[model samples]
Target chain A: MEFKNVTVVKKANIYFDGKVVSYTVKFEDGTTKTLGCMQVGDYTFNTGAAEVMEFLSGELSVELPNQKEPLIIHSQATFEVPANSSFTLHVKSIADYCCSYAK
Target chain B: MEFKNVTVVKKANIYFDGKVVSYTVKFEDGTTKTLGCMQVGDYTFNTGAAEVMEFLSGELSVELPNQKEPLIIHSQATFEVPANSSFTLHVKSIADYCCSYAK
Candidate 1:
């Protein structure tokens, strides 16, 4: 199902010198999400709250701090990251993702 | 430069049975843009006005009606499509693009 009621945020954010770009969206229930794209590179991200990431396109290799092996996530797949922890993403290609945060 | 003022649209449009998905953004200048991702497939799109397409990541092979050869667009590249015409996009890999329409 598509999100027909969420409002797209007004501003865009560029991360890691433009290697990653994302826009924000606000839902009716006062929750927010971010839709972003990552370039072909390795980058580290720190999160304050838990995140559920949904892959829109391309492939992504994700490595959590506690995981031994990197998880290969493809299109239409979902992954989870814990709060107060950091994760590394090794992007093989242009990858699009939607990140939903906990309230 | 990033667009910090444009607002993301509330509704999401899914095309070709979810092969392509896009979200709208409204600028302060009264123009609108669409940020979308395309899966691995070849699809056709018809436009009502002139469009400027910018590649965010990955690669795309585009074929216009008047052009005999397909144009390969990579990251940080841009292409134009005429108004009231249809163009075909051959997506070899997952690609991310931003499309702006002429007012």
Candidate 2:
């Protein structure tokens, strides 16, 4: 589902030479999410909590450490990353996404 | 300066058929700013307060009601809008911007 009734936190965290940028949003049920954009590049990210990422625009090729083949996610698609794991995202274009974190 | 110490709001407010998207950022001094992206289009916006808009990427042609010619702003450039006034932005590409509001 799209975010229609969430409170956006008022801070921005930029990473990797300004290639990836995102903001935090708080849900009514105390869960938090991140919405941001990524430029064309390959990025490695380590997650402490499990995350479900929803793509809003562009395309992404994701490589999980445990998977043999890379997963291709297009616009309006969703992917998940396990907790305490690292994943790599291969961005072909400027991608916009929303990430929901599990509590 | 780019956003580093700001807090991102957890909600998103979409406008104009999702042509423009942005999230709010709160500052340490209690000031608020907005960071977002705009697709290629012509958009007219009315503001209740004064705003300084900084272009992060792409190009923008802005026309204020009092100005005779449109102002061309490039990436990393900034433009200001007066309170209670309206302005039009002619977007050539997907433009990223950061807007700080005067309170």
Cα lDDT of candidate 1 equals 0.76
Off by over 4 Å in 2: A1-5, B1-21, B24-33, B37-79, B83-103
Q: Cα deviation in Å at residue B73, candidate 1?
A: 2.3
Candidate 1 lDDT, B3-103, residue by residue in tens = 55356643345676555767787777888888877666899999999999887765678998789999987755788999999999988766677899999
Could you tell me every candidate's TM-score relative to the true structure?
Answer: 0.58, 0.59
- For model 1, state the Cα shift of residue B63 in Å: 0.5
Residue B5 of model 1 has an lDDT of: 39
Query: What DockQ does candidate 1 score?
Result: 0.09
Which tens-of-lDDT digit does each residue in B1-103 have in candidate 2? 4444446654454666556768777767878888877777899999998999888776779998689999997766788899999999998867777888997
Q: Tens-digit lDDT track for model 1 on A13-73?
A: 5677555767777777888788877767899999999999887776778998678999888
